[model samples]
Target chain A: MEYRRSLLEVRDLHVEVEGKEVIRGLDLVLHRGEKLALMGPNGSGKSSLSMALMGHPGYKIKRGAIVLDGNDITGLSPDRRAKVGLFLAMQNPVVVQGLSVTNFLRAILKAKRGEEVPIREFREMLVKAMGLLEMERSFAARYVNDGFSGGEKKKLELLQMTLLNPKVAVVDEIDSGLDVDALKIVAEGINRVASEESAFLLITHYRRILDYIRPDGVAVLMEGRIVASGGPELINQIDRQGYDWLAVKTA
Target chain B: MNVPTPPLELAQEPEELKNIRRKAWNVYTQAPFPDRASTLWRFSSPEAFWIIPENISSMLERGKITYKLEAPNGLLLSDLQQAVSDESVPVGALVGPEFGKFEALNLALWERGAYLRIPERAKIDQPVVLRKHVSGEGLVLDRSLIHVAREASLTIVEVLEGELTGNGNGYLNAVKEVLVEEGAALTLVEIDLTRGTTRAFVTARHSIGSNAELKWVLARFGEGVLKANLGACLSGQGAKSEISGAVFGFGQGKSDIHTFHDHVEKRTFSNIVLRVVLQDRARSAYTGLIRIGTNASYSEAFQENQNLLLSGDVRAESIPELEILTDEVQCKHGVTVGPVEEELLFYLMSRGVPREDAVRLLVAGFLEPVLGHIPGDFREPLDGRVAHSIKPATEVENVL
Candidate 1:
């Protein structure tokens, strides 16, 4: 194992949704700048882990401790967690009808920076980021995610990641609905945001996105717990032989 | 409540004008208080809007009702009394006691009124502003008539405000009648920012002629109680009307709004979009109707009412009704009443914005469709009012 400083640690996390345990006893760790891909079957609680980490009110943390950098953040609110450098890219972004994309992005930026960013400067940054995501200039003026295509929604998630530059990013199935071209652009965006001080936890059900942005490590989650963890070879094994073998072994 | 006797000065007015007032007074005295079982009065009680005769007389004697009008050249803008005496305007033609009780009272006792006539085939570069202010406690009556001549284009902004005195409760009854002639375009914006303690009753009726267009915007931000009846009749072919409204209610405010789109001719078009945001213990009830008559073939009408509840204590009701008597017409109506989506708030909060700020953003977005229709000069002030209304009660009290 490499000797790298840890950025995020989830210790024996137990999450409940609607009074039913989802993430029973999951433990995970991501070191600085490391890209860890979490692979699981359809009902393996992958999305639950992402939502619980972000302090979703619907996802109750039954028992766990989430440490970011060196602070215990299990009791913090969602906005507090974000302020301490945590970001979660939702699987399905909601449609806000009248909130323009530019206004939403600027508001988040202001919240993160604790000060107002000059309009001209913010416009330049937003335009540059939109261009990188292959979005039109008029995209900034549109209401947030309203009437947006599936691929466009995914691109918007990546665009936020590129701009926020958080220390820990948990992207849940960002590649689920993207086309080949949009997947390439989104992959490029994630790679660009990966830095020495930032760690990535990619949650997915397929190996296609892993091919675009290689993962430093792979972990398999099954029935609310991490059943296996290893180097990139784990992904290859899962690709060849589906999770049935891992499930049998873990059981 | 018994109807107050006609003012002594009423006898001195022109015979025609006095006759209209006398007829309206009779109607007001004869009409019974609206029954709660009626659809129009189901959500609100007429007692909340009842005005004492003594208060009305006192306010009238003290001259507490005032009006200011600003218009361009070649436009006919005059006092309602002058316009009626000169035989230049037909008062009480569109609205009368038959409309409603409050409307009849407004027509009979209105002390502050304006009549605006736009010349034929003329285009006004600037909007005509009518500001009606009631400065003392008691009952205030106001009426206005606007006629946009054929092929003429004009915009009118009506601002209603109140300044209460002492511990007395204030009541305001207002009526407006607008006529858009053939091929004319009229944009009427009514902004009501009455005091929190004032009870307001407002009724407006618009008639659109052949090939005419009417755009109506109503922005309500007052507290206390408000009952508004806004309607438009499409009487000619190729006529179009678009009504957009936004209301923000806070504290213990109660608001009941009704809108009507009556299509009487073929090939007419109408759309109504109303958005409301309620905070604190505020409550709102919205009922809208789209009626396409048998002769209104090939007409199209759509109505949508959306209410956003900001607190658990707040209540909202939305009812959209559609009546289509002819086949070849397209009529649809939708009503939505719900609290802000938790998913939306979570999405915004996950990006570092606080919960309060996130809720504010969602509410502002929910109201943007209608608020965006406000004129540029008034948009910012209304935005401020909305922002202030959404704050926590304790914080709002502190700021106040």
Candidate 2:
């Protein structure tokens, strides 16, 4: 028998934000084209784990090694890590005043593509992508998420995900504040970006999002560690028995 | 050109004009220069403008003025000497000596000026450009008098450039007075991109008539010290004014801007937005006031000043004040002075944008409220100047 190494491997992760430990000794493995649903009760450090993997400044890695595609990316800056193909769909998108959506998207695309796109082509691509998210054409003219509603913010993050086309994406609570229609649209958008060449880690607390986009694996994150991992049946069991069963089993 | 001495008297000038200049000079000489103790001059270095009357006169003489008219039909454009001599143009009614000390000095010794008069009910759709250049180390006093008659409309653009020779410094003091008659409209754009260690002082006073409208846009990207005093008086019913300005200060430059919106009549409206970006050791300060008089009922006034500091050593101060004596009027002022938020920076960085470029984007966005308000023709040039001003701070060879 032969074993295949995972595309992303988190080994003995211990993360802290502002000198307080949040994610303690967590380990997870994800393969290319795999959708891993990270589920847990509130305060289980699911978001912290995702942020730690992305090398957020506020989340200090006390002890961890995040290997991406056989390269150690634990010490890279957030921007460098992004250039290396890591993307995080933040739960609450930041409202950047004064920067238009078009300019911001063009800049990020330019930085990633390593060349400036012609104005006409850039505008065309932006309009097309905005259309996919059902956003108004005028949304590109407004400041970056300056006055967007909660669902609109989520759609914006998803819009960037499709445009940037990262190799590995960690979507943190992408469906938390979204309505049912927005949730389906966002899930469809996520599915549009997820291809055979990329991997996804969907960090969520609710089970509704899983209904739209089927997950290949389900992992229960309890007390800062992956206490259980299984097929889609695990989601049903957790839905029926709640996370208490997993907590008691871990204890 | 040799530096001229103070108390310059033109023998051929009219007695009334001569008497006005003499009175202005007397007032300018007797009034002491503004000191730091004065609340208005606290953020600026008062000694930066300390000079004798002869030096001020000399600086005013070195500035050259050119008047370019895109629509020469229904407008009268002339130099100060000719405009004052012509009986048809009422120069005295446009500018007066009671404005301030800077106005006094400028009105008394201005060597070069442009007077523009638009005929009643005529609309000059094209922009009238006024190019004023100061060469060598001297004083420059340039005056602009604009009169838009009843139901008329005009657009004016003023560009001030200074090129200092050798190691000498130049001082440019300018005054612009605009009168928008009943049902008239006026749009004025002022761009200051002077180089060297020259000092610039611009005082602009506008009077809006009944049912008239005024829009003023200012861009400041000079290297030295800049002091701008802009005021608008909504003296007639249904008058409206919108003033917007963007300033980018880099290196060791300092910029101080003061704006006032005086609503004196019923149903008047005014809005002011000013944006300032400071990098390196530069500093900028903005003081805005909105005054609603007793009879200015149903008036609406809004003032906003936002400042962005790119470096730790840079400083930005915003002060917004309001005095309302009338009821049923709406007036609000907002001031924000801070550096770029860490969350915004991190959000951009997370999307593969380098730190330096992220900062640049944030700074550019900080000025958009004012930059977007600029007329389309002037927006690109002003945007380019702002980008050039912050180039040094944003240049990065490599980011880890």
Q: For each candidate, what is the lDDT?
A: 0.85, 0.81
> What DockQ values do the models have?
0.53, 0.63
| Residue runs of model 2 more than 4 Å from their true location after superposition | A1-5, B1-6, B56-76, B88-95, B124-126, B165-168, B391-400
In candidate 2, what are the lDDT values of residues B73-114, reduced to their tens digit? Answer: 645567767767665555445456655666787767765678
Residue B162 CA displacement from its true place in model 1, Å = 3.9
lDDT of 1 by residue, B229-309 (tens): 889999999999999998888888889998989999999999999988888888999888889999999999999988888
Give the C-alpha lDDT of model 1: 0.85
Winning model by lDDT: 1
Instruction: Give the worst 10-residue stretch by lDDT in candidate 1 chain B.
Output: B391-400
Interface RMSD of 1: 5.1
Model 1, first chain, TM-score of: 0.98
| Candidate 1's DockQ | 0.53
Output candidate 1 Cα RMSD. Answer: 3.1
Docking verdict class for candidate 2: medium
lDDT of 2 by residue, A162-181 (tens): 88998889999998878999
Which runs of model 1 end up more than 4 angstroms from their true locations?
B1-4, B7-14, B52-55, B70-76, B165-168, B393-400
Best by TM-score: 1
Question: Who wins the DockQ comparison?
Answer: 2
